[model samples]
Target: MMHEILRQSLRWAILVTLITALLSILLHAASATLLRGLPLWGGMVVVLIIILVGVVFDMMGIAAAAARECPFHSMASRKIPGARHSIVIIRKADQFSSFCNDVVGDISGIVSGAAGFAVVVALVVSLDFHEGRWLLETLTIGLISALTVGSKALGKTFSIRFANEIIFRLGKLLFILENRFHIRVFNVKNKKKRKRKRGVLRAPRTD
Candidate 1:
């Protein structure tokens, strides 16, 4: 079991690193190409999208952690859409939180910074702004940082407030993928037998 856990960890680490690296390259290349001819506002749009991605996933991490399992159990017993799948994800809350908030969120931050730099370079070259180049670059990077951090800070509050609802909805989406689309992305088998055994042990005496 320990070996299997370690193997899974290593596998996830390698896969995440490769995905982040490839995404970073693609984002940088796309940003450079798209911003080369776009106006300043257009470039800013790309930066905003990156920030949004980071913020959304950060919120998802919080929601996943904060979600209650009892509600999921009720939903699952009632055969609600995605309830069982939600329970599966909620069971591994720590791992899901790390994946959503740390891995994907950090990657988004890196990609955003890269995109910001690309935009800055594009602007400098297109406008031939020799003077105050350092200042312009500083402002651009600073704006990107502010937006990314500030949005996440604000999102944290909302996530905590609406955590259950958010996670419930996410579970529904995962359910659709698993049942209709034939993709069990979370790969968790239902543990109903364990719960049932516990319930039997706790039952009141009928004697």
Candidate 2:
């Protein structure tokens, strides 16, 4: 289990780094060109907009993660009959939570790293350049940061949605199995009825 966890962590780290790097490069290029034609104040406004977008995306990612980890669905399955089916449903739900935690942790880490890089870039640009150039640099950094956060948010949302769907399907399957198989593994009514019949049969030849 520890080995599996470590492997998953490594994979997530690498994926997040690659995604963040690619997005940063693309955003840096695009923002650099776009901000070139804008006035200093206009560039600052654009940069702030980008930062706001990043923050929104980050919040969305967190929300989706929270939804994925929620135990409501699992709890609902407890009302289902049949111990075997309930166990399967609960296991699937637990797996969903585990996946959510890993993916969300990686995304959160990426967002933090990207935000730090943006801040550093902003500070450096402010010190190294003046007026329009500094504003343009800040805008570029902000755009890159926004892109990184947005991409992670989108990816996480997709993952969470997919996981939820799987859990739903699993729950449905469990219901079907319970109805069709009538496993009676934990059917209290069936067990009690069988016991009563047995008792009647064994009640001696009182006839």
Candidate 3:
């Protein structure tokens, strides 16, 4: 078990690092070119949008972790695809939380910071805020940080309150994609599943 845990952890570290690097580069490029062209308010709007995405996913991660197993079983018994996906999320809540909240959320925060800097640069160039340019940049960065943290703090309450419903809805979406488009974002294999497969392989052939 310890060896397996270590192996999984190592894999997660590599995957998350790669994903973070790719996303950071894309976001930084976007900030440099796309956000730089926007007006101060427009850039702030972009920052807010990124913050919203981070907060929403953070809430989703918490909700998935908090959801009970019985509902997933009931939904699965009904042959629901979303419930099936939700079952996997619930089974590996820690990993889900790390992916959604830690990896994605942290990336969003970093990108938003870059966007905020772009906003400041835009303001400094377009507006006559040359007197306290440094101060303006500092305030912009501070405001973005405050909003991001505040939104996540508020989102946590909602996540905890409506965890089951949120997870169920998310499951439905996953179900649709998996059934209709055959797209699978996550297909984690549990130890029990591996054991069952092994048992079948080891059993004497009836035929």
Candidate 4:
């Protein structure tokens, strides 16, 4: 059991690193394309959007970590659309949170910072303000940092408070995507599901 846990952890670490890098590259490339030939304000808007994405994903991560599983089971008994789906997410909440918080959230931060640099460059080019380039860079970085940090803090609090509801909403959305659009997100096999049927509200303890 210990060896298996270590193996899974190491494997996840490597995979998450690759996922983060890929997501960062894709987002940066998209940001570059978005900022190309756009006005200064437009560039700023794109940066703000990037920051918003990060905050939202961070909220989802927090919610997943804090969400209880038993509510989902109750919903399932009532034939709710997303109840079973929610259980799948709850089952893999740790991985989901890591994917959201560490992979997408961190990538958003890095890309947004890069986007801020692009914005500063754009401002300098548009205004020809070479004298104030340092000030501009500092202010731009500061503003981005503030917005990202502040919004994430608020999201964390809100998510913790409403984790179950947020997760149920997510499950509903996932159900819609899968059933209506035929997009399978979680391929939850029935492996040992009965054995784990009476699982606790939290994730099952390995030790």
Report lDDT per candidate: 0.84, 0.50, 0.83, 0.91
Alpha carbon RMSD to native, model 1? 6.3
For candidate 2, the TM-score is 0.37
Candidate 3 achieves a global lDDT of 0.83
Taking all chains together, each candidate's TM-score versus the true structure is 0.81, 0.37, 0.86, 0.90
Tens digits of lDDT, candidate 1, 78-140: 988878778877888887888789877998898788888877877888799968788888998
Q: Looking at model 1, which ten-residue stretch has the lowest summed lDDT?
A: 191-200
TM-score of 4: 0.90
* Whole-model lDDT, model 1: 0.84
lDDT of 2 by residue, 1-207 (tens): 999998987886687567656665666665556566665555555555545445444433334343443454455546633333333434443333333344443444444444444454555565674446656556665666676567666756764556444444444555676579854322323223443344445446775
Ranking by TM-score: 4, 3, 1, 2
lDDT of 3 by residue, 1-207 (tens): 999999999998899889889877886787667675766677778888888989998999989788888877887788765777888878888888888898889989998988888778778877877898999988988998899999999999999998988988887888788779988877833456433344445567797
Backbone clash tally for model 3? 1
Error of 1 at 110 (Å): 1.2
Candidate 4, 56-138: lDDT as tens digits = 99999889889999878778888899888888988888899999999999999999999999999988988999999999999
Model 4: lDDT to the true structure: 0.91
On the 0 to 100 scale, the lDDT of residue 59 in model 2 is: 38
**Candidate 2 residue pairs in backbone clash:** none
Model 3 misplaced stretches (Cα beyond 4 Å)? 188-207
